[model samples]
Target: MKVYLWVDKDIPNVYGQVAVRAGSIDEPADFTGLAHYLEHMLFKGTQEIGALDWAKEKPMYEQIIKLYDEKAKLRDPKKDKAKRDELTKKINELSVASSKISKGSEFPTLIQAAGGTGLNAYTNFDQTVYHNSFPAYQMENWLKLYYDHFQRPVFREFQAEMENV
Candidate 1:
């Protein structure tokens, strides 16, 4: 990770950005939009940051991924409409259950509560960037949040987040 800082006495807030080299270009051709989907998931928070019960949520989260994998394997959506619909229903059911135990918006909520603004992320062909502005004194807090943000992202609320992407 690389860091850059710009300080100005007149500005009351600190604007921070963390950009990673991976983006759409890094995604596998078969999985186009994977990078953009990841950008959205990263905000969903990590194992330590978002889960009310990681032990329970983990299994459901895994099941959701498996269902998606299974759904993806159905080469003919129209022909396999019945099977695809079943998988979609299962995915949605587990997603809602998993969400109950997950802190879906805790990451952004924490930032907003701390006087942070412009909290958002974006992905392009070459890179993805997460950024926000916060009171200068909260620099340490911002660093800690982001440090945990990048570690072990849980992918909770996968279905709802997928809609956003």
Candidate 2:
């Protein structure tokens, strides 16, 4: 469901947001922080938004995940230094390889280029909301970007985003 408010004021910008009823409070105890983490990922991109070449990048991205999974099982980096360093090196290599195919910021850049402003999203106790203001004439463009975001989002930059969290 989508909701829109058409203000009749003289302002030249249109303000709106897409929200879901689910939030942090709805998450299971073991999945705490999941909602906010997902919110952060949404900005990372959609398949078509932040990708420079999905065909080439996909394999590299998968490799990163695989490497990290193996790394996770290693115990005490100080004692498992050799294995830890090996996995980290491989992960870094894949990250660099995949990053080269990244458009990285195509989402927000698309909106900003089209005269959209205040593009942002947040998650809290009861809801996660994505909001943006666009020039009145750019409403259609805004919708196009927003729909792309939700319909085909890709979780890029997971490592960097997780660190920030």
Pairs in steric clash, model 1: none
lDDT tens per residue, model 2, 12-115: 88887889887899888977999999888888777789898988888887788888888888979688899989988888788877878986678889988988
- lDDT for predicted candidate 1 compared with the true structure: 0.88
> TM-score for all predictions?
0.86, 0.80
Candidate 2: worst-modelled 10 consecutive residues by lDDT: 1-10
Q: Which stretches of candidate 2 lie over 4 Å from their true place?
A: 3-11, 68-86
lDDT of each: 0.88, 0.84
lDDT tens digits, residues 1-165, model 1?
Answer: 677777787888988999999999999989899999999988888887878999999999888888989988899868999999999999889988888888978899888878999998999999999999999988888988898889777777777776777
Q: Candidate 2 overall Cα lDDT vs. reference?
A: 0.84
Candidate 1 Cα errors over 4 Å, as ranges:
5-12
Error of 2 at 28 (Å): 3.7
Q: Pick the candidate with the highest TM-score.
A: 1
